[model samples]
Target: MMMAVGVAERTGLLETAVKATIARAPARLLPYVVAFVACQGHVMSDIAILVIPPLAALAFKAAGRNPVAGLVGAFACVCAGYSAGFTVGALDALYAGITEKVAAALPMGQEAPTHLLVNYFFTASASVVLALIGGFLTARVLEPRLPEPTGDGSSGDEESPTTEISKEQRRGLLLSAAAVGVYTAVVLVVWLLPGSPLRGEGGALIPSPVLSGIVPLLFGAFVIAGVVYGVAARTVTHKNDVPKMMGESITSMSGYIVLILVIAQFIAVFNWSNVGTLLAVKCAALLESAGLTGFLALVLFVLVVTLLNMLISSGSALWSLMAPVFVPTFMLIGMSPALTLAAFRIADSATQMITPLNPYLFLSLALMRRYEPGAQLGTLMSRLAIYVVPFLVAWLAVLGIFYAFDLPLGPGAGIEMP
Candidate 1:
């Protein structure tokens, strides 16, 4: 995540492209463009919130539209899309690693080898669902409700500069795209070729090197793409600039890294004490006794995670705490580990928009106040709740349908355990 963002920032790939796209979009489509930008939070919520909202505000202003609802709507989309991205990235790696580690501690843990793409299908689909819903609400519901902007069109910040895509930037973007294409081809060849190294023994795809080594693959692809873009874009004039950007990115993430370490230790302690497993067993037994062993229990579990998300804003941190208990519990009751993760992701993401503790929420408020000088936190929260309520209800329905139909959460990852 840090690596990709650092490169994007240095090369101006994300911001410049987004501004250019929005600039070209029809006035009536501006809201949907903002929604699309916000849905990109699936890639990096922290980055999306910081970069997209301000640009969206600028777009709204240029289109002679009120920025209030659009800005808030973009924030809402980012929060909702945080759990699902178009492609697998660091968050997928982190969550899957945690799930695997926790699952390994269970009695039947060895039967369920965690794969990087465990929730890929569901999450990728979820990205579309969120984008569509957010765009619809922004266009049909929220925007209509917002009052006209009264003050000067300034967003309290200095006006955004005209962001014309430079020839060099275009070349850089194209070259970066080429690099990614080549890298993806190589990966596919390595995985799809019979007797390839990435394939498991006897060429099995599951439990293969591709799944287990996906994190490094992700890192390599992003770093390679970033470097190519940076050099082409002149962001990296010297070789040392690469390491400097990486260092700065990592340094900026010191707080999050520290949090992950603390949470990792807590997970370790919990697992060592056998508390999570025992609790899972008891919970599963209790649910079974109450005739809530399947879809109903899954729905209840999601609601519990949603409540937990209000207090704990970090998805990975919360998953570290919850997966150990919930994954095993779900698996014990005939649900798959992948299905449990899918439900947790839906709940965690849907509630992010409403969580006061979410750092992004405060950041979003600050951004909103830039447009509406009088924007109060409480008022914004109340307005945002309008979006959150429907988003949650719709998402829960999606989850329910997914559960009831016994959908595949990902490739070879069905809702039922063996």
Candidate 2:
């Protein structure tokens, strides 16, 4: 899948993958599937966010730009927590539970993220939008101002625009749309009307069935439709052309799957070792004893969180360990639960853009190779200061604003009162 995605056209390739993810789900959970998956790991991070590195690579590759920050940011967003927005899958349950005050930190807190959990859709979208802007800035400004870094992706694969969508392609699109629309209609009816045929039929709380065999439904729909359209439009009359297009997606993803499974095992082993628990415990003590408290304490906490995130990659586990003590402690000092959580998130999210312990950091390095060719780890780090400096300033300034005003993060959230 990795290589195929690397070579495939950006626009259609993601559509194919998105459909594949949905097509693989079961029918019972179809309602809330799209929004679920789209917002799935809504809290903690998930592997589905993995798509960022490749897709971000494609976008920058197309624009003739640097992909380091894009890929790193994408990976960091997923590994840390689920709110990074551009992707989703498992972090939702984990994050939701943490903020709900359920589980304890891996070591001390009663919850996983121990810190305040962020609203997924809100944060995730921010990551995507910010990443695009960052990438754009780097391509248009930073790349030219400084010495170019080394890279690992193929610059030779320039995507020239197609002259037009052939009739057959149009037909395929219509089919794809119809199939998705039917699935969507079912979900919305159930959610809004509540008396719809599909409502509460299974375990689903909401009806908007958007996935499950639905994605495969889209895969089948788009491919068949594309083929039908191809034949009529003279773009693909032969069986051979159809297979060739479909084959591209499968073959390219194979490497990615292999890498994912291996990483899964490594993470599993790390979790089992209780290292995260021990580390969070140790860090919590140091911070507490240092006598950090209230808003001033939060500044120190963020600095530490950002520093630790560089060494350990799991954002949920890190917060899980820290939030319990800090949240209640900060609350006692007049800070809001929501604001406390938001601080940890900013710190956690910031370091991923440049940290080394993150595994995907390597993948992004490879992406950089595609553009700079001679780009190295050292080089990427040196150049990142440009984007990071601005982002840090922008990111923290906003956080400072929230703290000063004692803002409300949402319902049942915010700073203190008299």
Listed in order, each prediction's TM-score against the native is 0.92, 0.52
* Best-performing candidate as measured by TM-score: 1
Superposition TM-score, candidate 1 onto the true structure: 0.92
Per-residue lDDT for 137-177 in model 1, tens only? Answer: 88888888887766553544566545367877778878987
Give lDDT for model 2.
0.48
The CA root-mean-square deviation of candidate 1, after full C-alpha superposition on the true structure, stands at 2.2
- The CA lDDT at 250 in model 1 is 80
> Model 1 residue 9 lDDT?
62
Question: What lDDT would candidate 1 get against the real structure?
Answer: 0.77
Regions of model 2 farther than 4 Å from truth: 1-51, 54-82, 86-88, 101-118, 121-125, 146-297, 334-337, 370-373, 400-418
